[model samples]
Structures are given as C-alpha cells and as structure tokens.
Target: MLEEDLLYILALQRVKGIGDINAKKLISHCGSAKNVLKEKRHVLQKINGIGAFTLQHLFDKGNLKEAEIELTYIQKNDIETFYFEDKNYPDKLKHCIDAPILIFKEGNFNLAKQPIISIVGTRKITSYGRDFCEKLISELKPYNPIIVSGFAYGVDICAHKAALKNELQTIAVLAHGFEEMYPKSHKKYVAEINKNGGFITDFWHNDALQRENFLKRNRIVAGISEATIIIESAEKGGSLVTADIANSYSRDVFAVPGRSTDNFSKGCNDLIKRNKAAILTSAKDLVEMLNWDLETKKERAIQKQLFVDLDETEQQVYDFLLKDGKELLDIISLSCKLPVYKTITILFNLEMKGVVKPLPGKMFEAI
Candidate 1:
C-alpha cells in the first residue's frame, strides 16, 4: 500500500472504540482510511453503527502522530505490512469479518498456494501431547504445509521446532509486539524461526505485552489457516478458545483423542462429543480429511469416452480437477470462479455422468 494510506490506516487503528469491523465500515463508506478521517462528523454519524463514541477519538490529532512514529519504526526494522485488501494478504484470513485490517510480518516465508494449519494446545503439555505434535508435523512433511502457532510454551514451540526440523515453513503468531518476546527463554529459537518461517502480529512494535493479548491473538491463529489441530488441552484453555474461534470462522477443527481419564484429553474428548471438532487419531486422518494425500494417489488408467457430454461450467470444473488431481470443493469453486453451491451442483452433475467421484472431506476427483 501507499505510505499515505498506511499512515491513515495506522491512525484509524489507534482510535479507541473503533474495532476492525467498524474501521472497515468507515473505510468502505468514505472510500479510504484517509477519506474517513477527513469525512464530516455528521456524514460519518449518519452511517449505520457509526455512533458518536467511535468517532470521539477518530479525529484525534495525536493518532496521526502515533501512527507516524509506528510507521517509522516499521520502516526502520524492515517489517512488511499487509493491508486486508492487498492481494498478498492471507487468502483465508481476508474472508474473516473480524480479521485485522493490517498485519505486520517479519518472515522469509510465502503463503501462496500452500496449505496451512494451526496446531495449538495447553502450555503444560504431557509426553503424549509432545509426541503427537512432533509426529503430526513430521508426517505432514511430504505435503509441506505451513504450520502456524502462537509461539507460546509447550505445543506452540513444539510445532515450530518440528516444522523447522522437517524443513517446512512455520509461522509464529505473537501475542505481544515485535519489541517483546514472552517466555524469555524461548528467545533462543527466534533466530532459527526467522530464518525458516518468521513472526506475524497485528500489534505495534512498542506495544506492551498483556494477558488478554494471548486470547486476542488466537483469532489470527485460527483465521489464517484452512484448519486447526489441538494436540492436547485441559477442559478449559486458550487452545479451546482457538478452536471456538476456528469454528466461528467456519474452518475445520480437529482434536487429537486421548485416554478419557487423562486430564488434558478431557478437552479433546469434549470437543468430539459436542461435535465441535473431528477426531484426529493420526496424520493419516488429517491427510485424508484435507485431501493432502491426493497428490500421492496413483493415477487411474481410465480411457476417456468419446461421447461423454458436459456443459461449459461443468467442463471447466472437470478440466481443473483433471489437471490438479483431487481438490477441495472450495478450491474448485475458487479456481472455476463459481459459487460453492454452483460448484457442488456441477460436481454432482459430473458424478452422474461418471466423470468424477466424491471423496472424504468434500473433495472431488475427475475420473
């Protein structure tokens, strides 16, 4: 984004009572963040949900000064900024209504065309949880997914280390700003993580760490990926909160099942019981559910029928799957530029014609 727009966006972000949803509303109505600041108070007040309180600090001159300072810091540190509308913004996150308008990134990784999943659990992890977390990442190595976590203790750090060991990109979503690192002992892993994947946060460089920040950061962990995996958790913990957020965003959630008597397993079992998450027994379950194993499936030697018929839309969807192998329904919809409902209907039609077959996890493969 241009510096001018970024300056105004930072100022808007600093305003009190104006969260992402409202900021986006204001920006949409005014056509730009800069325009929103310059818009007449009466004009803004007329917009739905734009009350007097949200606008109280909207016009604060100090907001601009703070934004300038933060922008300078960002530039000095070589931090990258992704506006919500930017093409480079995380694709899944962009669809989330509550996603941050802008995210600051410091990493060597690129998210383009890669599958991403967040693995989160209790800070007090058990031996079983540790083993499961490590094994899951190692097993997923062939798919080369981008692993995401909060960069906290236990499962978070374990996931990061596993991804690094497997030579895969792993993103650490921070609850604090780039200026501070929590659990100071984990600072030792920072250099390696930076070299491999890197850190992401919506917080400013100098923002102080706060208890609530962890919960707030969970949304990013949940929203930025295709799915979330909880290796272990107590009946109540931040990882469960992340699961809830993932569900709210309509993302897939999986929980590693454990002995019912185990304290940490209670959360996973409860989630499975409540139908909030699917049972994750091993890497194979996740691989099938996400269609990540499709690439490894041997090609079927089926001869094409000379008389098989298909419409333009159906042909488009079929052609994509033929080239890409089995793919998620949403991916097909996106690639075909068709609505999901339309894609499903077309896929069904293709199925009827014996040209496609449905698979687990809402995926379809051309026959």
Candidate 2:
C-alpha cells in the first residue's frame, strides 16, 4: 500500500464509530480510505449504514495528526503493516467480515499454505489441560502447523512454549499495543517468540490496554486460523468467546473433554453438548479431522503401504471406504454396523494408517 493510502487508512481506523465492518463498507463504496475521507458529508450520509454518528467522527483533524505520528513510529521501528486488500494478508483472516482493515505485525513467519490452529483456554489451566496442550503440540509437530494463541496465561503460553520447543513458528496475538505487554512476566518470552513466530495486533503502538481490547484480540485469534482448539475454559471466559467468533466465521472448532466436575472444563463441555464444537481427544483426532496428514509425497507412499497390513476392523473400514469412495462418519458407522464413537476411533486409526482421508463437511475418502 502507498504511504498516502496507509495514512488515510490509519486515520479512518481512528474514527470512533467506524469499525472494521463499516470501514470496509466505506472503502468498498468509495474505492479507498482517502476517497472515503475526501467524499462530502452529504455523499457519505447517503451510503447504507453511514449514519450521523459515524460521519461525526469521520472528518476529525486529530485523527490525521495521530496517524502521522503512528506512521513515523512504524517506519522507524521497521514494523510490517498488512493492509486488508494487500495480496500478502493472511488468507483465512482476509475472508472474515470483521477483520481489521490494517494489522501491524512483528514477525518473520509466512502464513502461506501452512495449516494454522489457534489453541486457547482457561487462565487457571489444570494439570490435565497443560499435559494435553503440550502433548498435542508435540504430536502435531510433524505437520508443522503455525500455532496461534493469545499469549496470556495457561493454555496460551503453554501452546507457544510447546511450539517453540518443537521448532515450529507460533504467533502471539496481543490484546494491547507493541509498547506494552499484558502480563509483565511474559516479557521474557517475547524475544524467543519473535525469533521463531512473532506478534500481531490491530492496535497502535501506544494504544491503551483495556478490557475491550481482549475481546477485539480474540477475533483475530479466531479469524486467522483454519480451526480453533479450546484446551480448557470455565463456564465463561474469553476463550469461549474466541470459539464463538471462530464458529461465526464457519471455521472448525475442537474442544477437549474433561471430567464433569472440573470447572475449567465446563465451557468446553458446554460447547460439545451444544454441538458447537467437535470432541478432540488426541493429535490424531485433529490431524484426521483437518486432513493435515495427506499433503505430501512421502505421506502418499505411507498411504500405499498402509494397505498391506490391516487388522480385521481396519481392513473392514478400508474396504468400506474403497467401495464407497467417500462417506460421512455417521453413514460409515450405520453401514458397517459399528457404533458412532467406535467408528470415529476406527477412522482415526485408519487415518494414521494413511488409507483414508477426512474431508470438510464431515466426509471421508479412501486414499
């Protein structure tokens, strides 16, 4: 994006009543942020959803002054800026309707063609949640997915540390600006994160750290990934809010199940009970569900070898998939006379064997 264009976009972003959704609307109608600001009040007012209050903030001169200062800071620090319309913007996040029109990034990771998953959960993570979160990332290392998290406490930090341990890029989406870190203790990990994955946010360098910023931050965590995984959450928490946002974007959501009495597990269980998220037990479950294992030539060779050694049940499932070409999990269970849960377990084993691949919309096909 041109410096002139970026300047206007920053100014537009500062408009109080105009958010990403409305800013996109104005940009779409006027062709650019500069044009949107240049258009007369009467012209902007005629557009749908452009009402009095929004217009009242659109032409503030202070916004321009602030944008210039922010732009200078950005230039001096060599921070990268991703304009929503830029070709280099995150592919998944770009599709989200409420995604920020501009995002500032401080990382070296490339998001292209890589599977990205956001892991979030309770601030008071239990021992079970910690073990599961760590093991999950360790097992998923072969797929080399970019792990995304809030960089708060508990599950978020666990996921990032696990990713770093596995030598995988992990992104920390911050709630505040670059000028401040939320939990001062986590400042120790910032250099390591930047060395591997990095940080991203829509807020300016000096934007105040506020309660609402977290909710706004959650949207980016949810939108940027193909799936969101909740390791643990209480009955109410920001992770649950992130899951809801992911669902609203029609992305896959997975929740780890816990004992009925575990407080942190309540939110995940509720999501499963309400049919808002699929049950996730192991790394294989997610790998199969997302078809992350079928992407390479070596994996294809493994797929061919899987047909050579099959137990009775594995052979039965493989044969069924071979004949049907592709089928839903429920249909496979019904036709093969296996229970649904049993069928899921069998399919997961089959996926690891590389003879079957899972598809979107809960479908599967034989390799």
Candidate 3:
C-alpha cells in the first residue's frame, strides 16, 4: 500500500464505533480509506449500517495527526503492515469474517502456503500438558509446520519453545502494541522468537496492555491457522474462547484428553463432549484430520502397501476405498457401519498411512 493510503487507513482504524467488518463495508463502497473520508455524510449514511453516530467521528482531524505519528514510528522502526486486502496477508485469516482490517507483523517467517496451527491452553499448565505439547511439536517436525500461540505463560510459551526447539517457525500473537510487552518476565523469549518467527498484532504501537486486548487477540490466534489445539484448560479460560473463534471460522479444532479429575482438563473435556473439537491423542490425529499428509504425493501401489500398516478399522476404510475407487465420506461411514466421526478418524489414519488419499468435496480413494 502507498504511504499516503496507509496513513488514511490507520486514521480510519482509530475511528470509534467502526469495526473491521463495517470498515470493510465502507472501504468497499468508497474504494479506499482515502475515498471514505472524502465521501460526504449524507452519501455515506445512505449506505447500510452507516448511521449518524457511527460517522460522527469519521472525519476527526486528531485521527490523522495520531496516524501521522504512528506512521512515522512505523517507518522508523521498519514495522511490516498487512492490509486485509493485500496479497501478502495471511491466507487462512483472509477468509475469516472478523479478521482485523490491518495487521502489524514483525517476523522472519513467511506464512505463504505454510501449514500453520495454533496451540493454546491454560496459563496454569500441568506436567502432562507440557510433555504432550513438546512431543507433539517434535513429532510434527518432519512436516515443518509453523506454530502460532498467544505468547502467554504455560501452554502458549511451551508451544512456541517446542516449535523453536524443533527448528520450526513459530508466531506469537500479542495483546498489546509493539511498544509494550505484557508479562515483562517473558521478554527473554522475544529475541529467540523473532529469530525463529516473531510477533503479530493488530493493536497500535502505543496501545496499553488491557484485559480486553487479550480477548481481541484471540481472534488472530484462531484465524491465522488451519487448526487450533487446546492441550489444557480449566472449566473456563481464554483458550476455550480461542477454540470458539476457530469453530466460528469453520477451522478445525483439537483437544488433548486428560483425566476427568484434573482441573485444567475439564474445559478440554467439555469441548470434546460438546463436539466442538476432535479428540487429539497424538500428532498423527491432527495431521490426518487436516489432510496435511495428502498433498497430491503419488506413491507406487506396491510401496504404499508394503510400508503402511493398517489396524482393523483403518483396513476397513481403506479396503472400501480400494474397491470403490472413490467415495464420499458419508457413504463410506454408512457402508462401513461406523459412526461418521469414527469413519472420519479411520480415513485420516489411512491417509496418514499413505494407503488412501483424500480428494476434494469430501471424497477419498485408495492409493
């Protein structure tokens, strides 16, 4: 985006009562943030959802002045900005309805065509959760997926560190602005995170850290990835909120099961019980469920059969696909006499085993 255009967008972002969705609406109607400001009040009000109150502060001169200051800071610090409509914006997040209109990124990794997943859970993580998180990333290292997290204590930091340990890129989405770092103790991890992946935020450079900021930050964590995993959470926590946002965006969500008696496990258990997330026992489950292993890689039929071992359930699905050539997911479930979710899980296993491949429109076929 041009510097002049970015300045207008930043000023428009500072406008009160106009959120991402509505700002998008206005931008679409006027063609650009600059045009929106130039548009007359009556003309703007004629467009749907643009009331007098919403436009009351649209032309505030102070907004442009503040934007100029921030723009100067951005230029000085060399901060990278992602306008929502830009080609370089995150692909997954671009599909989300409520994604921020402008995202500030300071990172060393590219998200283009990357398999990114967010791992979130309670700040009060248990030993089990920590171990599972570490092992999960280690196991997923071969796929070289980029990890996304909130940069909070416990599970968030654990996920980031685990990704870094495995030599994978990891992005930390922050609640505050570029100038502020919450949990001052975690400052030590910033340098390493930047080297590996770095930080992302929609907040301005001078915005203060606030409780509401975290909730708003959750959307970025949820929207930026192909899936969100909850390793542990109490009956209530911010991780649950992130899971909800992921579901709302129609993205996959996974939860690691834990003992029923454990406090942090309760929230994850409830999410599973409510069918909000799939049960994630290991990294294989996630890799299969999301079809990460089936990127049109072809293998000789003999080689596929030789190296892959299928349990009874996986064999059932694979055999059906082999005989039928290609089948819809629902038909496979009914023909195999398994519940839909169970059938899906079995197919995922087959895909991971390289015995079956997933096609578009929920279709699957044997290798």
lDDT of 1 by residue, 1-367 (tens): 7889899999998998899999988987898999999999999999999889878989999999999999999889999998987799997887677889989999899999889999999899999999999988998898899999999999999999999999999999998889998889999999999998999999999888998988779999999998999999999999999999988776789999999999999999999999999999989999897766554433332234345778889878887777555667876886577999999999999999998999878878887
Ranking, TM-score, top scorer first? 1, 3, 2
Cα lDDT tens digits, model 2, 77-166, are: 999999988888987787677899999999788898688999999999989999999999999998999999999999999999999999
Q: What's the residue-level lDDT of 118 in candidate 1?
A: 98
- Candidate 2 TM-score over all chains jointly: 0.81
TM-score of each: 0.83, 0.81, 0.81
| Per-prediction CA RMSD (Å) | 4.9, 10.6, 9.8
Model 1 TM-score is 0.83
Against the true structure, candidate 2 has what lDDT?
0.89
The number of clashing residue pairs in each candidate reads 0, 0, 0
The C-alpha local distance difference test score for the whole of candidate 3 amounts to 0.88
- The clash number for model 1 is 0
Which has the greatest TM-score? Answer: 1
